[model samples]
Target: MAEEPLLMNFSLGNDAILVQPKFKGGRWRERRGLRKATGPTGVNTDSILERHSKRQKTGNSDGPTRSIDYQRRTGLRHGVISSLFSYNPKIQSVTDRAEQESTTLPSNAPLVDGIDTFTSLGLSPIIASHLLTKLDIKAPTAIQKTTISRLLSGDTDALIQAETGSGKTLAYLLPIVQRIVQISEQKSKNGNDTNYQIHRDSGLFAIILAPTRELSKQISVVLDSLLGCARWIVSGTVIGGEKRKSEKARLRKGLNILVATPGRLVDHLEHTEVLDVSNVRWLVLDEGDRLMELGFEDDIKKILDKLEQKKGKSGAISDLPSKRTTILCSATMKTNVHKLGEISLKDAIHIQAEADAQQLLQEPTTSTDPIFSAPAQLQQSYIVAPAKQRLVTLYAILKRSFSHKGSVMKAMIFFTCADSVNFHYEVFARKVGQQNTSQLSDSTPELPTQCHSSVLSSVNNPDIMLYKLYGNLTQQMRTATLKAFSRNPNPSILLCTDVASRGLDLPSMDLVIEYDPAFSAEEHLHRIGRTARAGRDGRAIVFLLPGPEELYIPTLKHGFKDKRVNGSLSEDILRKAFAPAIASQTRETWEDNATGWQLEIERWLQSDSKIADLARKAYVSHVRAYSTHVVPERHIFNVKELHLGHLAKAFALRDQPSNMGRGGKGDEGKQDTGKHKGRNRDRSRNPAASDIDNARNSAPDPKEAARQMRKALNAMNPASEFNIA
Candidate 1:
């Protein structure tokens, strides 16, 4: 049989060659011919040089002699082959083994040397010490462990997806700071021979973009803490609430790192000339999903365009490297986040940390199904009550939660609108103050105060303190509110709208109460993400209404279950919480029952009026906010219940009973005396029905008894009628 010619192809620089081997008798002959040669533009010179740089450096005399000998043997120029084949075969094999050992291990994969510390990831000794001693961060979190090495050792962009409070901030910040430190040390070693001209006022090396001002300020605070005692590393925050002149001054002072909101950063880039980020090596978009949800896409694109232009212009003028490594961190990987990554990042390493850490190098595809999973450590439950009783339920829950002595439980309560937040704060402040008043004088006793206003404005009582945060508040007021909640050293509650939900790094938050559910499941995730962070235990209680609102719990539960997560609220928890809250009656004042039938009629009227007032305030605020584009149109709603109902469906709450119209009145919830009397009459015929009726009627009728007592008191004193109104 004739020997089949074997054809093998190999690469030679930018060209490809095919070798045809022929066997004749007992010997073999080979013929080599160039198949194709690519043009210089088609050649990946950077990759070629990168591979060449990995070669082991040999003795200078032996290196050149070997390269010359190889060039002469191959009939190639010394210059061409010298750059490609600098290392000997033995050294090349060792380098290849080292490169293979450095690859990322899977989540379940064992470590290379079982060394899993900050120092092992190439962080500077000072930073590692600070993390261990000052910050008390002894070990890297799942996200940090997976990403730090990739971020610091190479030019790999990263998309980090860890649960909220899983140390994502530190994951990116540590490596970024380390890279900056390494570069700084190199520049210092080079002294006057440094290729880049870095100045005190133009030392911007990193930019972190947060979705909101609060988040931006939070990142700045965390960075400040981490960079503690690293005096050479200076970080600055540029948000909208701050003074432009002051921020410009800070920019002039030269910031090694900048944390900013997208719009404000874009404003500075357009208006300020002193600010320069041409050589920014790291661009981190924290809470990337929230940034896209807040409609910062254009602003983000604009900033990126400016950065690209700046890099291009600077590259033309200077020999300094201007490549940027982008880090996108989000709790959920939404489509918009993936789109943002594609637009901003190049060859990113995706590190997702839900159940495990999986490294993906290609573009990630976001699932069409909604993701609604809370942290595993978070204990989620809901209380079903009427909309009119929301405040009372909240008051009761707070009263129960903070009843412990010397307990320092900080809670963040989210409302649907600014009006709801303000109204609840005012009512809570007044009611708690009234309850705390001295009966002997009918006035508040002199007490230590932290707020400016004395009319229920300051609540420094040890039982509980009150603070409000909303978009309407001035920047100063918001700052004071956050500070009070953060540093008051007492049990406190922060009544806020969605403004607090995104990226505020509230520490030691014992609970998060959704006074009303978020406008969507996404917002709900961010809202509850405030707690159960960084491996800390926390709880969240959602106040759901009885009818359609009660359905939201199971819907949200199923969404998480679909993701194979244990985000379900235990039935026992819900049943227990809802039992007390549902059975509890609304507080009816003594004066509300002055006249026999007159008081009863007036009480109903007052209840309706209060509900109307709440609805009106919510509607007005919604219109104004959405009309002026203060908030997104989707966020516009008439009341908390309406908002809750709307959001529930977004989270996959299907088959929701539509019988309850905009009125949303639940079965006309009126207690009928004749109906109870009739049920008592049929007690013998239907024992089960009678038993249920008896249980329902067993709860004390505070309103009816108060009416009878007030009627008797009214007959004694006609002047009490004047006091009623």
Candidate 2:
């Protein structure tokens, strides 16, 4: 019987060749004619086929046998070949890692056995009982234990510096509240003086100045909660974004404990006649470092001068402390913080919670420039990703974090500017199909009605909810957004700028993601401080680019006191993020889906002109904000070393960096029409018009001109009007 002819097909580059062998006279013979190649391009199929034909002619081996040998040697089998085309390194999914538990008390929690309870720290029994039963605060934090007694004395000004989330708020708050309550009780006991009885009409006795509006609101909330036991004393907040009329109404109604931002407080002091500062005794500057950084120095100086000039001018109202005790609270001690202390404090006692009370008292200046640390119970990690992979990597981190529906109930992602926050929030919302595409206004005054629905869903997680907050949003919107995110019990994510980075205590915040690094190490500390607060166990991770940004790791290690900061591979994160997709399809297919999804974002930018403009504005603002890093840390965050094109890709931008910020195709013809006509008229009038035009052209590139304009606008108002929603 004659053997059937055997045909073998081999692919070389973009071409393929067919070889047929025929059995004749009990021997196999090769067919010389080649079939058309149809494989990957760029490979030389002719030379490979020629070499195989020559080998066969020399009687070295049969064509099929040599091809089999070559296939085995080069791992060119179908499975192996397919794998080569879809090469992805395997890594352990983040889901497989064991959940970490808090082994140590929070840094703010009392480390020693002495003076653990609030009552032991000089708080009245009523206040202590209220704290324990109503607020569930069983004990005093280290800062509270050390500073409470001194602040309660009401004679010495104190500079309270402690790690973030270490109870600095209560360190000053409790003492002032305790004194007010005591004075009120004393007046009530004296039946002869009903006029001195503390009520809403009582003079404003305490002023708590916070750096951010959210923090001021938070402080007011905490004070209100504490005052549940003492209902007569009212606490109110005056922040920047709220209507001044309402704030004035509250001021006129009287607030025994007033919480305010410095700028707003100064404005009230200058404009409002009802704001009485003559009887003010307690001045608490919260987040002092941030207060100085936000250029509130002039406002704070003016406030101090006004307080001093009007202090006790109306005399004591109810036997409250006669002296005005200034308490300055900060996490880090910088030169500006010290200058702020000089402006607000007098004969100040330096107090820090990180050290022992005796040691701190003995060497008050030892921690003058101490490094700030996150909560001890916090698990801090970082991932170094390339610019192109940044967005997907972040998506993966969030996916892995919320993989288990109830495991991570809340997560916060911090960006550099409001524009970035707006851009990213919209991207994620649109990706999950939660965003309303029909909404034309990016600056929606209210969150979508769907956001209020408790049963929210996401593509990656079934119960995920998305919220965003930034400075550009209206004050009412910011307040409502924060309140909703805080109250939502389901798993949620908040995309925000540093507006949420100060002393605002978010509830059940299990994870904090620094999608963009802070300008300073101290600011980074504050960003991660959002989670793992008040002795609660939490996790934080930051994204760093692969170039000079990696150098920031050492700086972080130094700032965090060389804490165990672990590094995560972006590949691992990506793999884990796409695990759900991979489980449903082949690895290659799932990878393609992810790639296609990213491309879809690029396409979306191209199709939606409004979103495209927002994206460009966001990218420009991000690069500008990146360049404003603190001088000492500029080496690691140098903007000159950044790959603008790659970074633009992270924003789903396909345009060239040089062409960014310029008007789109539709606007190209319309731009500078009047100016061009003037130039043409000049050209027609004088021969030197060309030279003049040359000089004008040599002034600056469009990108540079746009950058200067943005800088000027930002200098005038730090929050960009273009950054909405």
Candidate 3:
């Protein structure tokens, strides 16, 4: 056999020394001869040996040169194999045990055999048939059953408190719609004239106020569907994002039901002359706690005052009640909610679903505080992950869920801010081989007409769809995005902020991942409430950082008042997250591939300036938002204890922590005053280059980003003081 040559390279200061090894008998031996070290072309090499001799004297030698080659070739493989197999074995064992022992609290209000159906609860036969045939609502939920009869009586104002997704919307809506229909029928019958019929000009009988435009639109949709059985009645929505002219036109035509957001409703009450409230009989504040949390107390107070001043002085309209009935619905009875009830409700009956039938019909009282709880059927859990592993762990969970053919078809991942949502959506969309739609023309035919412009599907896996929703999106886009997400039949994921947390009922939401914890425990309840809706079996998992964040587990448990809420350190989920790489033949290969995946993300961020800027903004905004946790929970989410570098890794950033400026506020102000003018000139001179310039200039100031975070936090906890500095 021919002799094999082995070469080894060593560095001494800036010089490179090459050595050859020879095998004598069966063992390897280093050659006695040494060639002079070479310096960077035409540099001196005499000092290399002197430095090596000094290292040998100091006993700081580089070990045997012959063994160096052998170790270099095999050391990495051994280390990686060992590490991969032993990754958090103790934690894995505990997680496995917990997984086996996991259990949920018995449903508080179990389904009763003799519960009243929609028809039995005083709904007309026509409405009941429409609900069953069109809406597929087979039965009234617990809250619906308890509150429908009370609302139908219209004897007093109502305060409906129930777990999220327990049919609070319908609890108030069904009664109002039924009353409107009943009044119209009675008027026609009493007058004994066909012209006595009620139409759109009959005046608005019900006003539904929601916190967000999306929720307002959703409420309008449900109201529209319920109105199908009585086409004579009309419904309309006036939210922040749509045209005021269109809303004015709708108001001019008259509507029996008006669903609106508080701000926009207040605007119309002050400006639009056609929006008459004199005949309004039913007022609903859906997601009442959320309305207060969003700082709508003033707007709501204005609305109530205006309605009272303009309320009809005449007697009952046909069979309808004389006084206006106000219904306030909320999942949590926080101090603000209680205060809101005091303001809007009068002689109100408090209704809640309870295990004890006797206690379910109690009147409103201020002495006893109500404990907020999630749905009993919801399977809630948490994962304690390091800051660096957050992104990968999320990826693992999504991958595992999507890998199954039909297990999880729809999922939601909630983030802290719009930037975070945008950042993650782009990262995952690009990873799945989809192009950035923002770079394309507005009229791109590649996107389906039914889908939003921001919605993207994986080229490799057509079944996987990604959607993004946040406050920054135009109202039309937000509405379109939500419509597409709710109707999508394939596996889809929505990355969103807290805007989607209240009163919006998304169908078949199998999973919810709280990538960022809510500002308060109540908010957390609302976030998880997105799943496990209407007695459906659903799952929710929240990610907590390894340190103080882990303490949040108990807080959540206490909030839910359920001992079954547990923290998991599941290796199986982590394995599944990295399954694409783990499918390889060897552990070493898979480990490398897994590591390479993260590196690939980091490289991608570096390649695109716009994406890199977004990642930094997301990281900073997340940290700022983390600081805005409610005062009681601040101990668990202490921002100073966070590892900025490690957190940056989750955003696929490779920069040092110190390099991440506080939102580039100083830099933004230092730019020339005519920078925008220069950009406009460039736009007219070269449109394509100006597009890139515009994108570069669009990165927001860090101070402004932090201010927005503080604003949102302030809205959630208006009493708390926030100092972002």
Candidate 4:
């Protein structure tokens, strides 16, 4: 019998882990200076010491020390000591527990604690006072509870899981300020030590990575305000589809902290060599998982790789490291995400919130809930409509969502595709009175508006609040829209593509509507997360048509579920999709089918004047306005619906053995053990399977599960033999 192998932290001093010789026993000594060797089986103290220096104490001047400040109670004099990583309350995985009901409100519904309060969270009284009086914080959210402690205590990493709007921003923000304040105070205390330039003028200590331009701009603004008030340091932003010269100028000075999007940031890094990542003491990957899906995975890798390279040799981490902390915050985390978490964080501290906190979320509280508390905010609900009627439904949702919020409209509608994004902009502007002809005629001709405040939506009595943003927005328009969205008192509605889905840093969003449900289960989790952010009780409404129900499930990931969540909706969940004709008649609209039809016919007429001459201009307008990319671009005809057989042949994922973790020749994914067969049962529950399972006898698979009986029948019964189909 042997104990299971455990994952251990590597001593930063050297690559070779210190192992003691065992004299025919299982025990090994944990002492210093055992021996020195060379080659494949050798140890080098000087090299180890050099390597270890990267992760040395922030202010340590010595090569080695006997004890680590377990509580991190000593000198962090080299820089700001944020209380974020430390003093984090130890709680359970209560937040992502999931709903008990058969249906969910939104795919990313708060699974666990939507935390509130800091009464006993161990934050210093001075910082707590600042939070209460200066920042107006009442409580902590799930993310805040986990991350704040790690940041404050100066630990390696904090991998946090909770829903959006759980006060994750302040979870990191407050501690960053606190650490800076502490560091500044320390330098003041040691005024006489001007002999060395080791810890000279501060360079950028933090780099925050966001998935979207809007989110990056928003977070940058928030950070500016926090830092501005304290006069801590200067910061700048690098985002896509925006003014390049201006952003480049900002980067030229080299900010004390930088907030950026993956794509644009890559461009900035490529062009600006002196941006100084080597001085980056902290890195924040906001909406990190979304970066992977945005076709930015390569870019993110390139950036991190470059940054790692900047760390001088062995690895970027090998340069001036001191238990470097990596924080991964997201609405939902699945099993595959664990690898991503591992890649981002080092020696991570996994923190999960309780489910009840998420279910019980409403308003901020003053006690017990130290993480954060969102205000009982936006009005949330769903509308029943067919996929064909998606646009009409969107217009209806936007009109009502913003209209009800009053004259000032601040809303962002999400779409799944580029065409959908374009269509909505046109139709909603003209038909819905959100915008119209006059405005469109003058809309910069080539792109959207640049003078954001004056860029009124062209419609009947255009409201003070209205805008459109996506990947295609000209750099100027995108930048202006973001600036306006953040400052304008009037509520504005900005149509969004998947580009904005990952991070919730979009400012003052009281409402979010997913025009089209997410493509994958992961998408659904991140989509509705836009609202209810940073201690604000926001509302998120997901529009689910009937055809998609089978694909929908409650909490398909490690956390999240279709159980009872506070303020959850059950009305919009359309059951039993209608037959073709019935569904078309009831759910479809003129803009959808008519515009789509026109678009297809026109595509065929392209390059032929006679064919084009036959089609009416009105039809073309409708076609361009309503038809989706698949219809207008002829993509639908090109892409054939794939079946299981086709998938088995094309992807061939099924060729691999089921339920195995085998790796390569020597050390495959397999753990080299057969004891844990039932460790992970993948519950790939879908509608078709549910339908078939319902048709089944409610018994386990005969071949797999020895039991032939249904529910009440036990596996122990041998006489319960059943016939196969």
- In the range 1-725, model 4's lDDT, one tens digit per residue, is 99989988855656456554322100112112213322344332344333434543334444344122211221111111111112222321222222232222332223233123453555656666656666665556555665676667665677665566565666677776666556555655566453321231355667788766667777886787666445646778876545678776777765667887766677767877656676566677776555543334456667777777765432232223353456776555544355457667777775555433554365333322222111233234444333333433344344434434353345677765443454445434433334333245323534343222222333532454555665544445566666666566666776766666665456677667766554454565566556655544455566543322322333222123322333221112211111124543333322223223222322333433332222222122222222222122222212232122211111111122222222111123243235323221110111222222222323335322212212212111111111000
Query: TM-scores across all candidates?
Result: 0.61, 0.76, 0.77, 0.54
Best by TM-score: 3
Q: Could you give candidate 3's per-residue lDDT for residues 85-166 as a string of tens digits? A: 2222123212322553325543433244332377888999888888878887777877788898887765589888887777
Candidate 1 weakest lDDT stretch, 10 residues: 91-100
Q: 404-426 in candidate 1: lDDT tens per residue?
A: 64443688889766656654554
Best by lDDT: 2
What is the Å distance of residue 550 in model 1 from its true position? 3.3
Candidate 3, position 269, lDDT:
98
Name model 1 segments beyond 4 Å from true: 1-116, 192-199, 312-322, 358-373, 406-408, 431-461, 558-725
lDDT of 3: 0.66
Q: Mind sharing the TM-score for model 1?
A: 0.61
lDDT of 2 by residue, 215-305 (tens): 8789888888989998888888887767789989999988888898776788889999999998888888888887766556777889889
